[model samples]
Target: MLKKQKVSLVVLTLLLLLNIVGILNSTQYLLKILFSYFVLIIAITFLPFLRQKINYSYKLQEILFGLPMILPIFLFKLKTISFAIGKLKHFEIFLIYLLFLAVVLLLLHHKDYRMKSSSPFIKLSISKKEVFLTILGMVYSIFTEEMYFRFFILSELEDYSYYLKIVFLVFSSFLFVGAHYLNKWAASMFTYKNYISQFILSMLSGNIFLVTNSLFYSLILHIAYNFPEIWLILKRLKYQQLHYENDGAFFDDY
Candidate 1:
């Protein structure tokens, strides 16, 4: 087993609050700061120069250091009460997600679990604004997802049998992707392929995130994926609200 830090109850509580507040505000500032910190942590992990300079005895010190920074994002996502209502109204979709996750778990256990690289595609240049937004999303994903699934769920499920641990790991991964799919499907932002890809990606990503004991890389990738789409959605909502208010004002004038 990797040398692990026993996170204190006080620390965990604080981390949860930080992650939740950051996401709830939908602000990019904290996100950017988190991504920057993630990069720093990643660098310190791989670079001997930085590693030697730091006064830490633990191999996974970066993970612990990041917890306080990451907690808010986790708390922010859970702060919303939408999940309670959605699960009630969209029971079929919910069941389908669970079923699909079971299939993914079975597939993972099969011999063909190795990853295959996709064909090379043209890449877009990263704009400053895009970079900024992605960093935000990265912060949000890293803190919130890691805390909820890897830390909170895993810690709580520790009492289960070894077989159950495996099952929980697989199911937790599925639930993570399924949650995204349900929300994205309702928002009309995600494709069927997108959900499938994300599910696979989440499984792989979760393993790496836990293994490295650093949520930084996972945060970067998620934020990069989510930033553009979320920005567009917010802009659209703002535009519609403005249009509606102006129309109301015009009627009043007439």
Candidate 2:
């Protein structure tokens, strides 16, 4: 068991490093797709080994409890879209406030603030095909991440004492955050705020896996948390393209 744990840790660490490289170096669609496939292959190859270690049963309740914690962030994104569309009526704003309050209360009741601590910034100029590929890549990447960080890393420490577990969790979470920071775009804007937020997300994700004993739950939460960021980025990209086209046409007419 010890030997297997050590080997898995080494493999996961190397994979994380490779993933960072892929993120940093892949500047075009083909390169990005290649890297994504590379990660997916590694993840799929290790799936069986990781699956054996997971004992958590899938229950509807886990999703039910976890989904609402994400509502506030989605609401915030929706509020942005609403503002973009037109002026929000007084009643609409008031209703949004009420919804936000309710979601906060629910999160507090469930102690889900950990999941709410951070948001990911996805700043990529991707085409429509790349967007589709990116979504698929993200899904696969999330699976691999849960397998490595949550299942393989965490399970390896299960037999140890609580202090050791906590230490390993923090250590792994730091590595997880470091991997994100390695992305070329993210690294340029890296701040303590991003670091802290990623740490919080990593910790919460690990805890969710521990509690639910299911990587699926962690993956679901991860996707739910990240989807809005992707949506926001796409919206911004579309708006920018429109503005650029309009400016070009105006100059051409003049």
RMSD to the hidden true structure, all candidates: 20.8, 18.3
The candidate 1 region of ten consecutive residues with least summed lDDT is 113-122
lDDT, model 2, position 119: 26
> Residue 182 in candidate 2 has what lDDT?
42
Computed on alpha carbons, the lDDT of every model, listed in order, comes to 0.44, 0.49
Candidate 1 per-residue lDDT over residues 1-254, each given as its tens digit = 11111222233345446777774452343343334333333332334444457866533443443454345445444322111222232444334444554465445432322211111211222333444454455555456665555544443333557676566567657656644543312346555555665666565545434434344444444454444445444444445455444323322433
TM-score of model number 2: 0.43
TM-score of 1: 0.35
Model 2 poorest 10 in a row by lDDT = 78-87
